[model samples]
Target: MEEHNIFSLIADNLSQFYEYTGFANATFGHILMILIGLAFVYLAIKKEWEPMLLVPIGFGIIIGNIPLFPGLSVGVYEEGSVLNILYQGVQQGYYPPLIFLGIGAMTDFSALISNPKLMLIGAAAQFGIFGAYGIALALGFTPAEAGAIGIIGGADGPTAIFLSSRLAPDLVGAIAVSAYSYMALVPVIQPPIMRLLTTKKERLIKMKSPRAVSKKEKIMFPIIGFLLTAFIVPSGLPLLGMLFFGNLLKESGVTRRLAETARGPLIDTVTILIGLTVGCSTQADKFLQWTSIKIFILGFLSFVIATAAGVLFVKFFNLFLKKGNKINPLIGNAGVSAVPDSARISNNIGLEYDKTNYLLMHAMGPNVAGVIGSAVAAGILLGFLS
Candidate 1:
């Protein structure tokens, strides 16, 4: 009888312990989310696409979906948790501006300054944001939610997160994930659009090389850029201000250490925090829904529209220019702010047709401008919605 009681007590304790374990709380949704998180890590490692952003985010997803039994303060949503504190940066929308500062410090605007016309291509790419906005409204999303969703078209993850956190906090995770995923998939999405929109000759055409931009011009551009953009859209000050300030640090031929810190450790730290918290926000219950699916579809459409618009706009813009002065439509897809990746894609495709026609420098012009334009568009949305 005593042995039997001891065995019974052991079984009871084992069952009680299992109840407190993730195994007991795990659901299909949790398992599905964990698989999705694993997929993210797999893509990051094998594909080498945006690994810096994806790795932390993927791990965070797993952590967030660990199926806690509740009443524990360790979960992201639990009050007074460490993750809750880290998440406050994302929720409050401060992470994005800091990311922008790093972007500015690291970015070399010489490409854009050398060819001002490419800025128009970047501006044209923003058509997708409005295009998605209309579609989201028609699909019955609220104005604010639609606005947050529309920013995904910019292919700028930080901007997407910033606008969504402020305008539609509930959709921040979906919007951010959509934005970053599209950004990562730029190479896959943009090349087909480029080929469809341009002829082989168009892809082969290489225009005059960009002239050297003076250091003085480089220094002045950020200052003037900030003043003009901020004056026009003060709502963008948080992002735009930091962007120009960081650029000034780089351009001023001074504050090298400050610029290094902003671009290096500071940005790295912020990226990890923002990526992890953003991923955590997508807890299985909150993320796996019809709404997120709709957002994903809308985000895809927006990115396609943006990519197509950039390429088509370049083709159209070429009409007024003389034959030699015509811009290569292949670089048009770079106007969606995927940065060096989009620019590199233009170069890769351009090389396939003509090994001599290097489009990297030229594509960088619109690519960098897209960064500025996306931020401006976000501010416009903020001004209207928030």
Candidate 2:
């Protein structure tokens, strides 16, 4: 009888231990999310698609999906967990402005400054955000959630995150992932649209070289840009302020050290933390919903709309410009603010059509403008909705 009781106690303990194991707690959603994470890793390593962003985010997805026994403090969402603490950077919108500072430090506004008309292309691309806003509303999301989702169309991840965090904190994970995913896929997505939107002659067209911008212009742009933009939509100051500040640090020449730190170590550290935490926030229960699917679809639609709007708008704008000054429609795709990626696509596709037509510098004008335009749009949305 004593031996049997001891055996029964041991069996009970073993059963309880098994209950705490991942296999016991795991669900179909967890497995699905893990597979998606692995796919992201594979794409990063094998395809070299946005490796910096995808690798950290992919690994984070795996970490987040690992089934946990209830009450464990190891998960990202569990209060007092290390991951939870680290996640505050994303949750509270601290990482985006820091990243913007890095971008400003790294960027050269000379392209945009040399040709101010390109700024209009950037502004036109924002049609995607508002277009998506209407669609999201039709789909039944609240004004705030729709506003957050719409920012994904800008193809600027940090802006998407910043806007979503303010407007719809609950949907931040889906919106952030959607924004970054599309940004990373710019090479794949923009080319076909660029080809479809314009004729062969339009793709081959090349404009005159940009005028050289002086040191005074470079140094003054950030200050003037900040005042002009921030004064218009002061709510965007968090992102726009950091962006312009970083630019000033770089262009000021006196602050090379500060610019280097902001563009290099500081940005790298913040990127890893932001990417990982954002990935972790997409726990199966939270991310695998029908709403997430809807967000992804809307995100794709928004990106497509933004790209088309830019290209089509250029075609319309060309009617007003004289020959030799008419912009290459290929560069219009750069208006979505994927930075050098979208600009590079513009250059590469133009190269495919005509080797002599180099559009990189021209494309950079609208590419960088897209960044500013997106931030401004986010501020406007936040002001009205939040």
Candidate 3:
């Protein structure tokens, strides 16, 4: 009888192990999230959508979703876990400044310097940030959270992450993912808005060549730009400071080694950490909430509004300009702050309308300006809301 009881106890212990393990404990929502993660991987590998970012992010999602016992305390959010340690860079907003450094190194400001007036187009597009802020507030988010969500419209991922980390750390996962996702979709999203807002004549219109910028202007731009922006919005100095410093390194002509390192290895490392931590932050329990859906909706609306605002602002500007000086409205779509992607879209759309109308160089002015504009907007919101 004792022998029989021992055997029964062993069977009961085995059954408890089977019942308590991840295979049995994981909910349907977890499965759904895992499948969504796999879909991201497919998009990254097969569709080539932001492959550098999405590949690591998708893989991280898969790693993050692997259900583990709470006692193990090894999940992304669990204290003392490796992922949680790595995620501190994101949470503390260190990754964004570094990413900005890389961006500044890669950026060429000659186009923007040659045509400073185009900076207005980038400024006009920022209304989308305020527009989305109001919308998010109406949807019942607090002012701080709303401010974070609103920045997704800026289509600037690092800025989104930076602002959201400060203003709404809880929503950072959804905000970051939404911002990057829309940035990757710039070609699809901006083209339709670009087409609908402007006519063929507007798209075909080409502006005069920008005045040649001097080496002095190139070198002075970073120093002057830094002082102006930093003094105006001290909160933005963390991002803007690093950005201009990196630009100075690139333009200084003597810092080629540092510039190359920032643009290449440093950026690549930050990107991988940003992607993985962002993905891991989206563990199903946190990301499956209604707020995540709301954030995604607000993000999409913000992007569309920013794009339209840019195109229409160009049309508005054309009303004042003589025909010879009028800017191409298509290039205004570059004001959504998706960097070269939006500018490239503007260029491609321009080519389709007028084969000879090369808008790339002109469009780059607003494209880089949008970067500055978005950072400023984030600082404004961070000041007011946070």
Candidate 4:
């Protein structure tokens, strides 16, 4: 009787240890995931690859890979766990919308409105999105998965997240990381392609000064544009509405305090949350797949194709216009959704050609339009997949 009692006690303790540690059952794949998460952190801190996002994502990846890491027993939340709470917001699709609001507050639409024709450059750049989607489909991804992957070409983080949430939630973290990573690397990615596509004469081509914009036009622009966009692509309302609303606040004289807050404190706070939440989604199990590698490769290719497409389209547009009205092909590269960074690069390259040339304002036309184009592309993907 005594021996039997001791044996039963040992068995109970062994079972409890296995339940608590999870190492009693962890596999090789699980260990590989932890290493990948650490690699992301190393790259973020050491290589500085979008450190804002990579740091948090790396931490999240680590936390997520721990076996039985408290409430992850069945591969999901069971309440009272840190990941459970964070995971809820992502699953509910909350972060992307809030992030959109912050993005709107940060954007300046003056350039886009002053030069509506540049909107076409933004539209032309989206060829990469469709082109990538076709390639992804060819690679054997389902339509929904390919759509999520293709938005990487847009180079817009929030739009990618929004599309991924609806189309391919499983690939969201990888897609978002890839999108932002390429956007940050725009300077490196774009110039080589631009140089290859345009000759010195094209690069040196002088562009006319953009027409002056009026305050009244600025105030009315967001409203009219929002209405047009909402009517035409209701699916884009979440992104476009927030963006235009932010712009309205900036342009409206009465909303100085609100605009200041949106551009400053509000965006800062949300960026922290957005960064951390995005990072947390990079758990090894989800991130280290063969598909994840393919997504990154596809995203990089999409960006290259988009850049090439934009430059070629602008050159094509130049053929139809009078000489003085011709646009600098460098500005065409800004049509991809890298925002101010790509636009700044365009301005820099223009200065390289002619010290007096200022392509910043001109480049912004396509830069802002790229935002709308990305949202539209995302909407199209959602339409097809959802």
Off by over 4 Å in 3: 1-21
TM-score preference between candidates 2 and 3, better one: 2
Q: Model 1, 21-69: lDDT tens per residue?
A: 9999999999998898888899999998899988888888899999988
lDDT of 2 at 252: 95
Q: How does each model score on lDDT?
A: 0.92, 0.94, 0.90, 0.81
Estimated TM-score for each candidate? 0.97, 0.97, 0.96, 0.88
Kindly list the per-residue Cα lDDT of model 3 for residues 108-190, writing each as its tens digit: 99999998989999999988888999999999999999999999988899999999999999998889988988887888888
**Residue 162 in model 4: lDDT:** 83
- Tell me the number of clashing residue pairs for each predicted model: 0, 0, 0, 1
Best by lDDT: 2
> Which tens-of-lDDT digit does each residue in 29-52 have in candidate 2?
999999988988899899988888
Give candidates' CA RMSD values in order.
1.4, 1.2, 1.8, 3.2
Clashes of 4: 1
> Model 2 compared with the native: what TM-score?
0.97
lDDT agreement of model 2 with the native: 0.94
Q: Relative to the unseen true structure, what is the C-alpha lDDT of residue 347 in candidate 1, on a scale of 0 to 100?
A: 95
lDDT of 4 by residue, 283-349 (tens): 6566778998999999998999899889999999999989888988999988888788888888888
